[model samples]
Target: MWGYMRPIKKAVFPVAGLGTRFLPATKVVPKELLAIIDRPLLQYAVDEAIEAGIEQFIFVTGRGKGAIEDYFDMAFELETTQIGRGKDISALHGTRMQPGQAVFLRQQEPLGLGHAIWCARHIVGDEPFAVLLPDEFMYGSPGCLAQMVAAYERLGGNLLCTLEIPIDQTSSYGVVDPGERHGAVVEIKGLVEKPAPGTAPSNLILPGRYILQPEIMQVLGRQEKGAGGEIQLTDAMAALIGSQPFNGLTFAGQRFDCGSKAGFIEANLALALDREDIGDHILAYAADLIATIQKGRGLSRDVA
Candidate 1:
């Protein structure tokens, strides 16, 4: 049914969203640059893609995103200054993309995720490409996309990273109508973009990761405004189901929706507690803070 999936060398990151949630902070720094522990959100996504064998990075950016481009480009003066000062240069190694491997496209309009993705269609060409939203950070053993890539090797047409969410919360995500289940992989019978509560087909929500065929670009091209009158990537994906082999990969990982304030803080705290350099200290500090808050509220000391 499937062979060892071809190595995915190209990844498309749609990062043109207006980070309205973060407000003033995002006014200067791109939301993708928000730090999760030590590295930026975009950097984590890039690292994961690299680990999954992605070599070419295609960033679909919008206005005021020059910082993102600069983040990946060589900082010649800074590197030279550090070298002259005898500072370690190793930290600068992972920040660069090899020649011809990084491409950027400007999404002139604040249309939608589908529009942002479509902006990179020419760069993606006809190869199978991976789409990662920097806002959704996944923590796992093998990396979320790597797991989906592994599944794609066997059944390759369009593969989505799916996770089970509370049925009551299905309206908040692109819900999947599952056909058949095989281990962690489910054949996608249909996909509905943020279906109304109780009207959702299934609780299998489409997170921010995708392994799609280039044909999706065509589907997106003719995509009519759905839901919020924006060209949704889910709608385009749904259009590809009958004509292609689309499956949902129930990934083994913890995903953080960094786009939301609560999810962002959770990701920071979770990753902070996993850091060897500061884990124990931060945990202790957090415990002390909780104790203080509890004492102030005249609550029980055995809260934990």
Candidate 2:
């Protein structure tokens, strides 16, 4: 099966959106650069791609996002300073990407996710590629993209990382209409982006990781604005349903939506709590904080 299909070597990262959610902080820094403990969200996504055997990273970027390009480039001054101080520089090794591995293209306008992806069509050419949104962090041992790649190798077609969420939350995500199921992989009968409340076909929702065929770019090329007056990627994806094989690979890990403020703080705490060096300390602190809040609430109840 692997030999019959074109291997996925390139990944498209749609990072062009203005991080309006983070506001003043994002005014100076790209939201993708926001740190979850120490590493930026973009780096996590890139690392996942690397782990999934991606060779080329195509970044679809917008204005004020130059820092993302610099992030993958060699840090000469910093490296020289670390070397002069006799400090360990091994940590910096993973920050720099290999030469010719990264290519950044401008989106030029604040269109939408679909348009952002179409911006990289020339680079992606006529091959299957992965799309990982930096804002959605998947915490797993094998990583989300690696899991999807493994599935792609077995069942070669468009694959989306899916997870079952509460039915009430379906309105906030692109829900999938399920058909047949094979273990963790579910056949996608249909897709509805942010379906109206109480009208979603299923509770399973897309979590921003995708392995799509290059034909999606052609569908996007002729797509008109649908939702929010922006070119909706879901709409374009829906167009390729019957003509191509579309399935959902249920992620076996938790997903953090770092695009919102609450999700960002939650991701920071979650990852910090997972670290061996600080997990216990963070757990103790969190316990103490909860105890303090509970004590204060009990006192207020008594007064009332």
Per-model TM-score versus the true fold: 0.95, 0.95
Q: lDDT tens string, model 2, 223-288?
A: 589778888899999999988899899998889999999999999999899999999999999998
Query: Model 1 clash pairs?
Result: 2-154, 5-153
Candidate 2 TM-score over all chains jointly:
0.95
Task: Tell me how candidate 2 scores on lDDT.
Answer: 0.91
Clashes of 2: 0
What lDDT score goes with residue 179 in model 1? Answer: 96
In terms of lDDT, the best-performing candidate is: 2
lDDT of 1 by residue, 1-304 (tens): 4333455778999988779999999998999999997689999999999988898999999999899999999999999999999999897788898888899889998878998999898998988899999999998889999998888887877899999988999888889999999999999999999898789998899989999888899989985788889999999999888888899898798999999999999999999899999999999999988988878864455956
Q: After superposition, how far is residue 209 of candidate 1 from its true place, in Å?
A: 0.7
In order, how many clashes per candidate? 2, 0
